[model samples]
Target: MATEAPKRSRFKRTLITMFKVGLYGSLLGLIALVVAVGIAMSQLPTYQELVRRDNLGQMIRVRAADGSTLVSLGPSFGRWLTSDQIPEIMKKAMVAVEDRRFYYHPGVDPVGIARGIQVSFQKDDKVRGVSTISQQLARNIFLTSDRSYGRKVREGILALALERKFSKEQILELYLNRVYFGGGAYGIDAASRRFFGHSADTLSLAEAAIIAGLVKAPSNYSPTADAEAARSRASVVIELMRKNGEITGSEAFAAEPADVRIVPTPKQNSVRYFTDWVLPQLDTLIEENIEPIEVWTTLDPNMQRLADQVINANTPAGAQGALVALDRDGSIRAMVGGRDYVRSIYNRATQANRQPGSSFKLFVYLSALEFGYKPDSMVEDKPITIGSWSPRNNNRGFAGAVPLRQAFAQSINTVSVRLAQEVGFRTVADMAQRFGVTTKVSTHPSMALGSSEVRLIDMTRAFAAVAAKGVAVVPYGIRRVTTAEGELLYQHESDESRVLVAPHVAAQMTDLMQAAVLTGTGRAAQIGRPVAGKTGTTSSNKDGWFLGFSSGLTTGVWMGRDDNKAIPGLQGGRAPAQAFHDFMSRAVASRPVEQFETQVAPPDWAETEPDEEVWYDSPSNQGQMVDADGNPIAPPPAGEAPLTQTEDPRRPQQEETLEDLVERAIDPERRERPQVPPRPAERAPPPRDRGSAGDPVERRSPTPQP
Candidate 1:
């Protein structure tokens, strides 16, 4: 009995010693934890300092004309809302989804930490996030987004400090205003505006639920990135809200995915091209400062979408396409830089300088009209040689005499060159510059054929000038610039009285272009409306273009390989014109139909006299007269020499006479029937007549006739 009692006492002593060691160990661990927390807390900024600090970088929020955001350049923030200013539903939704024990916990939730630790142990020690709202705000304002044990410890200390310093309402308000959402939005207000096109105070239950769901994975649940995923996430938030007693079952059921209307984001980031083009101009408009600014642009979201769709759909494989649309006043309505913005950001519409081909004939024809040539005036379309450069019609044969309208519509190379010669090359270049083409236009003969490279936007703006009935149209994208506080910085204003062309001249040019779209090379561009446009195909088919205007809108399209290599079987009248047709058809569906002004009547002196029955040896077919199709035909029973006409009365007297000019331009020895060379191998079949429905013909070489 005595031995048993001694043993029992020893057992009690052992139990007591073990209990004392465990208590000392726990107290030492607590002291270490407190010291570590003190160290972390010492490194953190005060809650007040964090609240006042603006960490967001320079933000440029670009919006469409209707006040919808097209893109945000940097971290975007909306108005800072106080506790009361925040919607109750938003608060509940966020609390329910992010941390159900947020109100009960003193900064850190023990239950959540324990659960997270268990999960980590089960998952091979992988770190798991168990952040509450306070922790998120601390991380957002005071720490980087690093997933490490050290970061987590610091985050917890900062959250505890925040909880002690700020009231629950203050913490929640700060948390809501400082969280990052997808798409560059930095706050709930900005996110609400970005995703739903409205303010957070006006957010419905469904929108609040969606915004709350984004806290877990912003990009994965971003409404703009994937509406379906966003709504699915929102459903989880709704269920959580119901379980937390934040909402009733009926209310949760009522929050349908369809009720969550997400603003349509630009597909393929195409709107970025427009935003990128406008971003640089901001420096010119505003003072250099880091202050957040808002730029109201003239972009029509619908038209921009359509432009993107059409350009991507019509651009051929192994090539790229670009498009630009402008209102009559030159407000850039839509722009597509390339087939895919992500693939290439080199904005072809504004940055690329490419030959407009026959589309450049607008200036030549406008100059001719200014020089007393009417649409009905007769012009010879025979092969002509100038300084060893013999330009031929696309079909290798020419129409001997045709109306200026017919020549323009057919995109006749010979007729354009003849008119450029008559009007003077310098005059054509000057006309182009005066009409809004900013590119340096050369006085070379090929310039009359659009060989000079120019930007699509400039070409579209030049066409807009014609549509504006002589008024100059300087293409502009930004409508106004303002500070985030709504202080106006700059507003665009244009002079309406700055006429670039005479109304009658513009009307005549429009008449010629209308003929081109109606019955000429641009027939493919007809949009079941009064569309006046011209087709352009550069030499070797390296560039294809269609510039046109209908219903007070001017749009230009260009298609080609980026390397400037020739695209097989490409023509401006084919893919480009069809793209134009497809885009404009949908673009102008809601607008009222309008007709172009009646063309000025031809002057008395412009009337065509009876032809003197001119005949010329076919450049091909060996001295036989060929038809428009380049086929040899029976010669006229009574052939006559080429007709000779008097000088135009409008020609300056000091200008060289036609006969002198012709003598100087042509080599007398090489004029008599130059030897015909055999046709070279072709990548495509021989082009059909311009009037045929087959592939539209275009000038294929810069020098030497076919």
Candidate 2:
């Protein structure tokens, strides 16, 4: 008995020691938790954050470069309403559905937290929030909706702090104003106006219940979609209200789940396409800390209006077309993304990737010139096949042994393919890349006919490079961004770099392209001024394009079906060219007439220039000649031996740079044409009246802004 008693005593002592250790450890843990909370609260945002509410009600305005507002984005247009303006039913509905004991407890509701934990851990449905109104407000305003125990703790602390800093009435008012409703509506006022076509002060019991239920999951219970779900959710709120004694049984029974009158939400403005396209760029520039920002763009309202007029005047119904115009510096001057921004916000000008067709020949010819081929370099335009592929011109017959200039003006597919084959297909692809075409280019022989797809914006930028005198450019819309407080947030710098088009090639190419507009396929686009451009018509007329540029601006027009189906009778030389002419004539009407910077004397068709000879020597090891597409090439078939590397015997023996070649080709002292110094911008031409070579078409009545 004595031994048993000793053992029991020892067991009792061990139990007492374990209890003491646990109690001390628990006390230390409580101290650490209190310290961590103190640190978190100390770093919490000040009362000024709530007071400013800059992000809550303010709007970000997108303005033209001239300071005219194009569109305003962000937040609803509802003013903050005080608690007195809120209806009693609204308050009761929110509390009933969200927290039944809101006024009884501190900011944190222990009962609700316990219920939420039990439900989240064991649930048939997904885990849902059981936050009280104050906790919700804290999460919505001060912190993010992160599903972590730490976030919940921070929310509870912030809610307690908020309750101490502001009255319950103030908290409720802020909560009502900050919440998001479905369909881009924010605040109770916007919700009421959007859903009921009235104000929050005039909300009926049924309406208030519907709105309160939306706080849980607005998109799921949107009245505009699935009214039954909305009414069903409202019924649950009504039942909660009755159980909490906030509403009588009669009122609860009267609030049946019936269809409530809902007003149709207003559509966004006509600048929706412009705004939607600019949003990603805008987001990239500004941060969350700044207030509402003001972004200045380069959009010209008058030109945009004129573009819409020109496109809608000629475009066939049911077919969509896009237009993009840019200045020499690559600032987007005008854009007509689609027929109606409200109906379709898929900005075709910036988004659509269509085959550029024969328009891609500009790059091919540019590559030819870079390979030491002159504008007058002759290639036999006879039928030729590479491996299993053969390309035929639009005319279906070849103009045999045509000069490169005439071949380009006529858009002869045979000549272009032969030129690409001679210069090496890889060389042509490299030149296209240098011109800023980022699409994945295929080395197939069909690429000479523009079989690959490319975006309109990209091609426009590449053509703008030509207008900028051989320098590649990046088309930009946003010029600068400023905050509402007038602080500079961001400013765009032009992205320009020297490309493959040398000065001589730039000059010679301009002369050829000008001939295209003057008498070639693009004759429909003649505006009586010096301009250079190309026309492209894809297979079965699926895509039509007119890419052109004047001394001042570069414009690209694409006409086709969005689904890539053929539009019979459509050609780049017809509607697309007409639209280009209509838009360019109006666009430059108020400006002065300016000729291309490197306009070579209108081709002396009687005799070739002295320096038109191109020479290349053959190396002994060049036996196994392979084309760019990895096909073996047979050595020159008969008289096609490599030309001798010799300068003209009659001409002076002086090695000249590309600039000198261009200067001599166009300068008045060396040629018959007057030399015009290149201007940084074509806008250097003074605004004046200039007469057109053709009959002046009367301006039509302006269309309403869509």
Candidate 3:
């Protein structure tokens, strides 16, 4: 029994030794933690800098190149200033509200901490904070927003070290600089400059007090953008000041007036017109961090006014429209995105995508021109069907036979569809693409009928290509940017590339478009000078588009609704054309203009008689001898359709079919006239019975005078 007792005693002694070791280890760990925290706290920056960074005393102003204010950043992002720069009342209010015993306490108040803990337990929330100026300064300078026990210990340690290293004034200054006011502002100096537009040293009582009020929450008390909210927050600060004995009841009452004069932010330049279109293009132009730049566009504000006037005068009351104009170098000069900038900031000129309607036929004719087809060539402007898709002329009947120029001038849909099919959809699409139509095109036959969407800027740029004689210039707004000292910072010129028929080919197209203005569908586009343009009136009158160009400028106008609903009784010729004319008259009022150049080369079949046979080259089969007599130089390829000869005694042997002829006429859809639908025929009244008596006196044909 005694041996067993001794063994138990040995176990007891081992247990005691283990307990002692554990206690010593824990003590060492606690000492290590204390020493680590002390080391971290000793490395804090000078308190003055922390105060300079946190004080809510700053203003930030943005300006246009012309020195006009565009916007102002206020106190939440404060400009730096010293404590003395602030009003005494403001300084006292902050101290009383944030930490009343700030001057007496080393860095923290035990009473405030106890009160905070008591309130936190009662409220079931961490709603009470007892952080003094020094503690706040320590947290802001070296810690994150974590609220763990470790963070609190670190904050306390740093606060003690801050008091040991700096005077109260210096600590207060550092505290002000290190606190975050909001809006990305780190210091009171930055905050002051951002909100009040002045240095911290020159602040007024109200301004300083209001800035001090932002300590609780910067966004909530942002004065420039949300004055009402700021006033509410300021009232809270005033109440706190009154309760803390920093201000008397009367003073608190006076501060409650909440009369804040918020600095007016500069207008957005609103860019109601082309700004939307211009924004996407700026990424490649400006450097990063250079923000809130004001672009003084080439928009002639007066011309924009005139455009608005004409559109309103002609358009239906509820209709919306857009107009874009570019100078000779393709610089956008003026644009009216819509009738009202406020009702809809969606820029119709740049955002709205609508069909071009008959206006798109220009590219078709341009393709035809490139394919050895002449403007005056004969084509049957009749009802036609391809693959069960039948298209009718605007007249709803066949013209039997008509000049290609005349057919296009009348905008005959049958002719356009048939011509598009024959001209090779690929070639026509290529022409459209080359002319600056960036939208994906419809590959079907109806594609020739303007079944594609295009923006005003793109359309205007395309027409500018015609004006520039085939050289397409990208439209740009920014010309130059310079520093305040006049050192050149940026200079931009047109990025140009050729995208269409040669100069002569472009001239032919311009001539045809001009004829459209003279006597065709675009008669409303006439501007007294040599002008080339096309008018597009979409089905159901949903969209009206007019794109035209003079010697030195190109303009595109569209009128429609925002909801895609059809505009009643609206045509491109009326509203859009008038808008175009008004803008052009003002745009070109002072500039000397040049006439459109004419085609220099004789078109492929220009001199050939209608009945004469002409040889043509095929893209696939080149230089292979096959005679008019049907003598095969080589046996026709197996499985191919046999080439048959037909005899036409009235003229020469007929080698091409009507389909082939139409195809040849449409190969390159360039035109000498803007195409329109044929005029429908009117029915004649049948002869009446009384006509029987008149029929007896039917006039006889006169004999040959010879």
Candidate 4:
């Protein structure tokens, strides 16, 4: 029994020893597992950060045609600036606040890390960072902006890698260049120039201090918007600079408030109007190695200014205006997109399509003239109601029976509608398209009165046809888009297509337009020189337009609101006409006069009846001078004396020489006065008695005039 008890005790002791061994082994395995996981957690973030840099943001630069940089788009809204240019005071202030031993640390500061560990346990806040400048840079440049344990572990690992790869000064310089200093400034150099308008090398003590203050929070210290807050933040930087020995206490105290002379950048007037219109045209002209070429347009700076001033002076507040000027050969000279371009970037002159209203009547007249209808063709201007649309005259009263010349000059709506119906709406719309007005013109009859919308550029092109004497010349701005070395990149070859109307027909139309200036609704656009144009006013006064051309230049003006709201009582002759007049007068200041073919009435025209009687109806009659059945009468007094139409002997005969005709046409105002075209020295006319052969001294007709 004693031997069995001894054996049992021995077995129990062995079993107890084996159990202790298993417990120690399990504990050792668990400790090893924890250490492995800790190391893995540190390395995972470093791998991820390297992968994230593949699509690092790129900066976009905008430059003028002259290769001057207008501005730049940066990653994280921060511009990268150089590090050597950073002010010493800003560098010292950063060191004082972020890490006192930044220069001594290799990625991680030992003292700072120990202190962070103590704080983490005592404060129970996982908020611990003993990062050196290199570590902070790695976090900003390579990692996501996440505050987590995993991120911190990876940040430290990556910082160690950076420290091993780059020197201490190199890491510091990278941090200074890559750190966000707010307002889109990435580096201290960019920040210094942005806030103080000077390079970091030239930064004053106060300026450097102010930029340093912005490092923590730029929004709180924006010198441009909040000067007082920026001053307070700068004071903090100055205090830190003194503590860090960057400056003495007395020097910091003596430093005045940063006289940060922030040079104001000029407003980015991107020439939105001209650019939008010219881009597509540019695309066609340019090919190969095409890296965003800058285009210097032919827009006259002075003309643009004048156009803006005239529009502002005439248009109502909040109203929009667009003006486009073109040289006679179809080169776009000046363009104003809107009254204030920055307020709205959608360029109206090029993009916005608006109703042309009565200004479109010129096309109608031209079409008629091309289709064998003369200016003297009689058309009744009465009330017209086609389908659901009813058009009324500007004066709200109709001319009973008017000639096409008088009707067009007065912009009579009833007469225009009648002409459209007679000549077919599709013909007019097709004619408009042939002249480069490519906007969708309605097939409806109302489109004859310009019910459809058209862009300012298209309208200008159509007018260029009139100015170019019946040629549809495509408008161009860059005469020759060339490289910096003046090698011809693209030459603006004139594509002049003969669209509608013969030269003589176009000349006749010009004559009628000239009459419009002398006595019609477009009288306001008349310059001292020979100018021909038409005025347009849409229904409900929605849009007002005046398109005209002098001897050398052609310009189109439009006035309206962006919302398309009505400006009641506004007419094309009011603001738009005046703006056109002012712009052209200034635009042609240096241009020499280019002579246009003048329209001369055939010798037989006097024998023919007047297109319509210019009846001076007494204002007392109230409505109109009408016969018993509401028919208009001849132009004469009621009873005292029906005035006799006298033929002036001073009028030069058509048999006169070409030089005499040229002189007469050159100075038309002289014709109205007591001046005559000088006779040839060899064949001078004899003096005539005023009373002899006053009735009809007619010569034989020169074959039948067309």
Best by lDDT: 1
lDDT for predicted candidate 3 compared with the true structure: 0.66
Q: Candidate 1: give the clashing pairs.
A: none
RMSD of each: 13.9, 14.5, 11.2, 16.4
Q: Enumerate residue pairs that collide in model 2.
A: none
Against the reference, the lDDT scores of all candidates come to 0.81, 0.73, 0.66, 0.66
Clashes (backbone N, CA, C under 3 Å), per candidate, total 0, 0, 73, 2
Candidate 3 error regions (>4 Å) = 1-38, 41-116, 123-203, 223-225, 235-259, 264-353, 372-387, 390-415, 418-422, 475-493, 497-499, 512-532, 549-555, 558-563, 574-656, 659-706
Q: Estimate the lDDT of model 1.
A: 0.81
lDDT for each residue of candidate 4 in 278-375, tens digit (9 for 90 to 100)? 65575577775333233445665566557767766777666888888887778776777887767777787888899999888877777666644556
TM-score of predicted structure 4: 0.65
- Model 4 residue runs over 4 Å out of place are 1-90, 93-100, 109-132, 139-154, 175-198, 213-232, 269-306, 326-335, 341-343, 373-391, 396-406, 473-509, 551-553, 598-706
Q: Estimate each model's TM-score.
A: 0.66, 0.59, 0.64, 0.65
Candidates sorted by lDDT, best first: 1, 2, 4, 3
Candidate 1 local lDDT, residue 348: 93
List the candidate numbers ranked by TM-score, top first: 1, 4, 3, 2
User: What TM-score would candidate 2 get against the native?
Assistant: 0.59
Question: On residues 1-706, what C-alpha lDDT tens digit does candidate 1 reach at each position?
Answer: 9799999999999999999999998999878877766676677666566555356778877899889978777887777888899999999999998988888887888787778778888986865856899888888887898767788777887788777767889899888888888988877998998899988999899999899999899999999989999999989999999988999999988888667789876554789899888888977887887887889999999999899889989888899999999987789999999988888999999989899999999999987777666677767788776666788889998887788899999999999998887666777888889987888987767778988999998889899999998889888999999988899999999778898866777888899999999999999998888999999999999999999999989999999999999998889999999999999999988998989984655444334332122346545645564332244445544674432212212212223433554554353342221111112111112222343532223323111121
After TM-score superposition, the amount by which residue 581's alpha carbon in candidate 2 deviates from its true location, in angstroms, is: 4.5
* Candidate 1, superposed: residue stretches over 4 Å from native: 1-55, 76-139, 142-164, 187-268, 288-292, 483-486, 589-595, 598-706
For candidate 2, the per-residue lDDT at 470 reads 80
lDDT of 2 by residue, 486-535 (tens): 88988898765555565556777777788789878899998878778999
